[model samples]
Target: MSRTSVPPRRARTALLAAGALVLAGLGAVSVMQSPASAAGLQCSVGYSVNDWGGGFTANVSVTNAGTTAIDGWALTYAYSGNQTLTSGWSANWTQSGKNVTVTNLDWNKTLAPGGSTSFGGNFNYSGTNTAPTAFAVNGTPCNGGTSTGSPTPTPTDSTSPSPSPSTSTPPATGDLVDNPYVGAGVYVDPEWSAKAAAEPSGTKISNQPTAVWLDRIAAINGANGSMGLRAHLDEAVKQAAGKPLVVQLVIYDLPGRDCSALASNGELGPTDIDRYEHEYIDPIATILSDPAYKDLRIVNTIEPDSLPNLVTNVSPRPTATPACDVMKANGNYVTGVGYALAHLGGVGNVYNYLDAGHHGWIGWDDNFAPTAQLMHQAATTSGATVDDVQGVIANTANYGATTEPYFTIDDTVNGTSVRQSKWVDWNRYVDEQTYAQAFRTAMVTAGFNSSVGALIDTSRNGWGGANRPTGPAAKTTLDGYVDGSRTDRRFHLGNWCNQSGAGIGERPKAAPAVGIDAYVWVKPPGQSDGASSAIANDEGKGFDRMCDPTYTGNVRNGNSMSGALPNAPLAGHWFSAQFQELLKNAYPAL
Candidate 1:
């Protein structure tokens, strides 16, 4: 339920030039038609981007300046560089070399004069990513010149922004359109890849990207004999091959980390906040800010299970532990986390996503709002503002379905609300996606930017296999229906170790859901969450009973039997059995 990891391309937009358009930094670079030319075309386009080295997401608003409704439109433009189209929303996008064309979707064909509609696409490129110089609307060879006020004009009564909010997929964050994952490839760790590939039929997901956990200070320089931070970045550079790529790093190792659980305790003690800031965070920041690795989009999943503990695992909550109480009293959790956010966030190419505990932990209304406030507090203190943090991540290193397709929180059976069911426990969310999206609103309400997005760790949350429910359960007792229909099959909602029946979740992908930046495999699938039995190591992980299959319940897990698999290795170590189980039970099935 807590503790784990965290982990744009602009391939999306070419506002064809025929009129005035808004390009954020370019300052009112509009797409305008000459007055003396054919009266057939008179409109404006707004182009904005979130670029990370080799790719970008282009968002454009095309406005009809003519008095009459301009029906059936297509916007055309040519990229000055070798930009290739990746994916787009609200338009039928096509590209040939530098020339790109975006035709309005059937739902968006009518461009009412004085009204504006927007569409965007993701793109990949090499060398300079120069803006397009020419644009034509609907076969009119019109001259596009600059004349614009704010980039986005107010939509008039007739302007239908194609792709209704209800009917179409939500788009990426525009204010921070420079999302690093949009058109970039994720950095695939050779270490994890080799282990996965060694398994039977493992090649299917071995090549996928996963985050590297720098759980200890030694990990920064390469713990044991593994790859160091710079070494990984160096390899990421090679893998980038002239295009933008992302390297995911978990900035863990805070003083008294994972206070509620024993499994992920860290090297620092409760009051060792100074060492955490200078020794751990500062060193990593120094390396990431180096210009050599600036081209790689470095994503830091700023300490999971840190600030959230101050809310759910401290005084007043039944789940509170003595360790959590100690850390809260000292206030070092906030200090360490705030320091990490400020230093790591200072790197221009780096995007820091603070970890929000999964829905199971904070979905209750009482816990939800306060958790967001704590996150904002951590972000603002220690020289960090909300802007310093890009967004948040949920279900890190934990199993929470990206969605529960079979049912929703609103479901009821025999006049009983699903929230009343024991499985739901009156919690507001039924799955990670709902909780994450709603938490995004909460974060903004708590004063983070409206542009702040969310990331869901889909690494082991798929919950698919033969036991996976095909549809909603038959109408019966509310508990029966909710339990039978749920995609997450945990014996109890609170279980959070190397759970049996867990499968690899959605493959790592970019800009997946509304308010979500990406679905990532931050906790590599095969890595054990903790030792099944008491084991000792120098990395600072402990053996929590939650990882013991034979152990009985805890207050956090409703006193149920621990559902973890037996004989698992230490946390963060590879467990072949776990990996194979994930492969076999994969939801979209391997």
Candidate 2:
């Protein structure tokens, strides 16, 4: 399905301040401590502002200092100057004359003792920008308000019956992996740091170093070997200091990397499968298993777009490329992944999540089962057990909706059932949730560990506001009307390189739904998916036609589509324009 393009609206991009600051023109600032508290419920607000001439971006963090947890929270403050809110994130922001109020979202309403959640905003001012002085939480004054009365005590019912003992089993301890990279202690890549500095005052893309992509064995042995993996691990361990330090690593440099596409070609030839195991996988395993870093929890996302290509792109025809023939003959894709899993799985602290191609790819009838079987084979091959894999990740480095609001498992689209559609056919019928659940069931039934979980990369799937549809149109045969009227539809499945209308999906959350472990930003926000055009680089990847905005290429169903996104930089490089667009169109309206 296709739709006529609607130009993205231009507005002040909002940013959430739960972590490192990337305010325009401002260097990294330490978290500001709240002033001395008043006597009532002890709530502190940390305020930070990044000023750029007549405009500035601000982030406020609310900390629960009281002994009890509050079910919901609201904060009110008045700007000292003529500041007007342009946009905000992580909460509902509103203004009454000079006073501005921020309310918590449903998922973040509960504020536990010592726990904190933050909200940010961009604003324009006439003359001066001054931080708000007065702050109140839950109708109580803060930063020095006198107690109005004794603290409210926990409530108890007067005439209620006694509760019965529970028969439910408690969830497994440490079952939920703590993504250390989520809030404050995440690693910051030097490249991201530069990007943030360069584009301060612009829409801040989450350039925080989230993962280290190892594309070649030489990256492990060079002077900056392991692509600074060890240094980041050391930093994470030190920052964690006995706490669970979760570090994400991407094992991407396979021989014939991205076999179906040219954008992410790796250095290794198809014949280097043995070298991949000994030089790349083995050394990474050694680093992870080191006794010093034993406490570190490693969340390894094994190659993106690798296994899926093997299933969909490799051909049985005699005309298949030499690389494809070699890859299939040597079992490089499956065996290489199996070797990494086997080696890494041996480490007690390591948790592996195999990439299940996004809903757009694996949602198809033909792709889902085969992908699951492939994951099962790879996980169990080379001495690796299904236990080596914790779950299958969907929508990795792809733009797929988190939920298809218009359709359910029983729904049909274009005369095809949602559950029975193919990648080329039902690109819009299913979402990540439906696809992940079905894929999980398929993998488990295919001999994978039954306890395997599912993850979705929500870093950039937020298609919000006017771009988001309310429902399918009635009495419409036009592809534009069909595609345009769908509530959760993306711009185009044919274009994956920094999709123009894509926005930030749901924020990182733990176990948001059944069979789902977490909604993670596996692909760090703001990093280029691939170069806009082919350029020479040591990373062993080439330019993909999809990254070129002008190229007319073959899309699904013999349709033709353009491969270009006008302003996107090369994959892995930072693009400010895309970052701004993501924030502006953030799902849930930021």
Error of model 2, residue 49, in angstroms? 55
Off by over 4 Å in 1: 1-177
Cα error, candidate 2, residue 323 (Å): 3.8
lDDT on C-alpha atoms for all candidate structures: 0.77, 0.64
In candidate 1, what are the lDDT values of residues 271-329, reduced to their tens digit?
87756655566557656755567677888898988888889887877788899999889
- List clash counts for every candidate, in order: 31, 11
TM-scores, one per candidate? 0.71, 0.63
Predict model 1's lDDT versus the native: 0.77
Model 1 scores worst on lDDT over the 10 consecutive residues at: 163-172
Q: What's the distance in Å from true for residue 478, model 2?
A: 8.1
